[model samples]
Target chain A: MKYPGGIKKQGSSSINYANRGMNFEADINVTNSYYINNDIAVIYKKPTPITINKVDYKSRVDAVITEAHFNTPSTTDYNGIYKGKYIDFEAKETKQNYFPLSNIHKHQIEHLNKIVRHGGIGFILVNFVKLNKIYLLEAEKLCSFIESNERKSIPIEYFENYGYLIKPKFNPRIDYLNIIDQIYYGGKL
Target chain B: MKYPGGIKKQGSSSINYANRGMNFEADINVTNSYYINNDIAVIYKKPTPITINKVDYKSRVDAVITEAHFNTPSTTDYNGIYKGKYIDFEAKETKQNYFPLSNIHKHQIEHLNKIVRHGGIGFILVNFVKLNKIYLLEAEKLCSFIESNERKSIPIEYFENYGYLIKPKFNPRIDYLNIIDQIYYGGKL
Candidate 1:
């Protein structure tokens, strides 16, 4: 397990003892649960898509699952409805100044576009590990960066120029919709 | 992977697949994806609810996921929107003449109750794997079976008496919604 800034791992003395990878997705889920419980919004992270086959329950009928695969070519990390509006975005973090284009795939970008087309707020949550800075960039800006002559990442300078910084926190952390309120609802929250 | 209705494996071929145990979820996902692409409806199998932490990238900051756990119980197996109406249901398969109550959890049953309370459609796609018989049982009736102390499952006689059977098909396979139309709506396809 790693820290919020993606720095040192959790010490052996820490509470968790699981051998599983840091529950990054679980944290978002916890955060989403918080949102749902508070009646603040209803958003959820899509599950890691998988296919199943060959379900063999001895007492139960042996079910045959033919094939399986991860459905998304890229990430559509978070999505839900808030205050009657749909919200969709991907959450990503890198320990570099410039987040790479490799993180955002073409298909993922298109997925965001689809979200926007359907009248949902679409954006990406990017964390600059070294700088310990996080920003929420809209789909339009992301598309331009991908389609730009650089044909690559959006420089840190560009992110600093255009992105809204997100402050990481504790207690159902990564409360992104607060930022969503600012961007989509014009800072009412 | 071994097939449910296919030949069994021997000669020490261990299962080393990510989707080793259950392919029922995967098949439903593929079937759902095909349904989504065909504009049949926008349904998605909820991703495995996970907790993420600890990420390390050379040039970029890693998003370290700290802790994780298996599924933390859920309300439905799949959810989506069809014709602007919320669709929710749990998928269960049994080889017996009756559907066992043990197949469902209390929380899941409660979840379906809430969905109906909120005016959304709630139901189950029950497949008798060995019998190759599928039924679309309304949540209302299910709740009744749950409320009674007479038995822990819906007897086969009851299914044959009241449940809507969903025959497996190739194109637009498992067209359960067609039955929904007949039951929930008055028109026939």
Candidate 2:
């Protein structure tokens, strides 16, 4: 399968989604990392940080990542660039709700708020593992739900009520950039 | 110590560079992650992408980062954003001769080339462990040496020739943001 914008040549690291054991996030990460490398549009998943208790630095300087628990709840899991516009997002996979705005952190919401105010594009790539469904909820809808959910729980129905479900595809796999092409750049994949 | 930009307050994680035994990259990572959560910036160490062979997702969700290995040589160590600007760089440390340009990858040079073409700020962070001196070398110059090093090797004299040495500091320790502030943001730190 050929992807425009020179995606087919993005190295095969992206083509194979390790469905054998990994869950939704790892799959999406491999896919996104593949896209960024191909220059399709620079996007990536932030590695779960590890605390380094010590380093041997045997030679070529490989500081092994030890078990370092996150000091705080994360804001968003992914951030990068598309075209020239900054791209930031969080990926959430839910079995029951698919996506209730409550899964997002408050500070993360605030971080996206900063992204939006700074003239950047922000959103979420929600995976409904049960439905095998994916949705690209724009930052605006996400923010609104977050603001309202503060007063009450945002039911999963609310998301299915108002969210852009991205049908998963092969070839470019997630092919998320296609959505960006239409929504942000005003075109079709 | 009060660091500018409400750092430690934004997240529970704080830079404990003293006890950290990891080489240069890990130190910067702890520091950079500290900076991001503080709302000072959003930076991440890009994970070395892997092609997974197996998975055992017992239930509908959740999987561990159990086993994986690099499918290819890495281009750079860390990259993310700061103040809405796309930030990219390679990190290296050496007890001798600062850090050799040869330690950097050719693909990384090409990658940074693309980053700069796209109107993003790109550079290399060099830590001289023996001398305890850090320098933010512009990608442009790094590329020059990388391209020419095929003839022989990058002489340390070159780095000793043109690199902005960054010293370790307390509040916001990595302080590359300060360099970014001066170079990309157009203000003094």
Candidate 3:
């Protein structure tokens, strides 16, 4: 199997072996770069928001931030144009059996709802790290679950039923776009 | 005329007075908020990209960045869904009679070009602050100019001729969408 960093693993029958000890965010970043290079999409993870309080201008191009504080992001971490459609999503990795709603902030959910209302594609990617399973849950279904149930977390079964499983693959790594094509683009891929 | 901060300025017939002493980025931020509040669009200026070097987790909620450095953005400053279309643009305020191409990074232009190629609306908003004139130049025209000429900057005449003029408004302040509607949506606004 093809592993990350272009290394081939001999006799590695499972995808988990390839992803073992790899960072989730880094994997997504690589996948995004792959998509960009292949001219497939233009998705990007937004920079972590911060409020700068102090800076040291060492030179014209060497200004170093001395003090800053993280600010709550008002929108999803990832967003861009995909096939002429506005795609927005947040991704998180959990080591538990259930995906906690608290992993996403309240304002972020509202922001996703607004995106969906404005005719943009909005969803969340939750990776059950321990189970080595990932699911892409649309904003509509997520909001429905929040409204209908009193539970703070969504079980794996619910994801298996409502969310689309994102099987890990070589080259692009996580093939979430495969599911996107199936669901939104009439299986054009 | 309706001034910034919702203050009504009397006997000011020109849009220049309303924008005098006001920061261009702040004006766009206020305009974006107005668009969001009115459900007109979902555009936003991305957070300034930075490379965090060190952080101090004083407590669970109060982690402070002690060292960081600004990183050049790979994409435009603003992008979002507008009328079910992917909208991407970079905004710049130039006090000079010509807008320097150096104001926009090389990769940013490439990124916008890719966006337009992928069926997204891509443009650059050049606000000639001194003339109180703002123009939205589409990616096609911008790239054409870059390809045909050896000029380091675009003259104000080029903007006046080829770019869509964005007139200042009361509630929305910088009404670029008004121009977008006229150009792309058959003046649906």
Candidate 4:
């Protein structure tokens, strides 16, 4: 059985919720790192938010966390500056044919809305594993979809219609920034 | 004895390192909340980075982390969009008359420099507890100091000369944004 990208794999030898969406996340991290190194952009994946409950001071510099729990993130998973523009986004993947709106939190959508309203770029990267396609859906477009339609999940057709397809490639892997450049900067890059 | 804003109080009932700089962090959190509520800007404190080891999934929704370790953050503590500009900064407080260079990690400085080079507004908020003063030191200015001088720490006088003093007040306690307005937008707000 194939697990979707975002779902946590249970009872695995490597039990890390940080690896919830390992493949997609790894792709994005590689892309962001490449962007930073090449001086094309300076984007970073915000660390997974976790609430610490107990810690043992093994040493001053080395503290071992004994208890903790992951908290729902208040903001997007990734954000940074690209071409002097504030960029923010959440990356997700699904084994299904459609991208589920439930994959994103309500407040995250609100946060993205606030970012866009304040003149920052905000979007979501949705990867359809079955279709072998990735799409960059702007927050504005996503919000309008939610408002116009009562669909809980965004169908592949909607993404094809409104979302910009990001072609996967070597080196940078997921070239979302190229799509951003095309849409926002008229392919200036 | 008054504990300075950034130092962690060790071994006195509470041991969560998240409280390493509680007073100053709380103040900033409150200030950022006020900004968001008032539609001023969209800034947020990135969560403390942690490397999760083991987890106990009591149920699907609730997962308890059994073992973990705090990771040194690669980027600054706070970042967001302010007035259609990318804003990034590390907030630190020093008990000494001089702010020590050791408080900030080396790579964080590099990260800030990259942000500034990319045309983002990058700065550091240094709170001097004894002096009862806070200063917003721009990344460019800080880099110049680091390059020109071999000084291990920045004297309060340097802050007085090179940094914009942030006057503490009610509501938005740390009014650093006001300083940004004065410097960046000529006090337009």
CAPRI verdict (incorrect, acceptable, medium, high) for model 4:
medium
Mind giving the per-residue lDDT tens digits that candidate 4 earns over B1-189?
234455455544333333324488888998999999999999999998988899999999999999998888899999999999999999999989999999999999999999999989999999887676778999999999999999999999888999998765655877789989998999953
Q: Output DockQ, candidate 3.
A: 0.89
Please provide, for model 1 over A6-109, each residue's C-alpha lDDT reduced to its tens digit, 9 standing for 90 to 100. Answer: 65545434433231124445656888898867667656666665443223334443322323333444447665556655566787777677888888777678
CA lDDT of A51 in candidate 3?
95
How large a fraction of the reference contact set does each model reproduce?
0.13, 0.16, 0.89, 0.94
lDDT (Cα) of model 3:
0.87
Give the 10-residue window scoring lowest on summed lDDT in candidate 4 chain A: A11-20
At residue B154, give the lDDT of candidate 2.
50
- Residue A117 lDDT in model 3? 94
Q: Model 4, B92: alpha-carbon shift in Å?
A: 0.8
- Give me the displacement of residue A129 in model 2, in angstroms: 4.1
TM-score of 2: 0.68
Error of 4 at A162 (Å): 0.8
For candidate 1, give fnat to 2 decimals. Answer: 0.13
Better of 1 and 4 by TM-score: 4
Quote the positional error of residue A58 for candidate 1 in Å: 14
Backbone clash numbers for all candidates listed: 34, 5, 0, 0
After the best TM-score superposition of candidate 4, give how far the Cα of residue A54 lies from its true spot, in angstroms.
0.6
Alpha-carbon runs more than 4 Å astray in model 4: A1-22, B1-22
- Against the reference, the lDDT scores of all candidates come to 0.65, 0.64, 0.87, 0.87
Of the two candidates 1 and 2, the one with more favorable DockQ, higher being better, is: 2
Model 4 quality (TM-score):
0.88
Residue B12 alpha-carbon offset, candidate 1, angstroms? 42
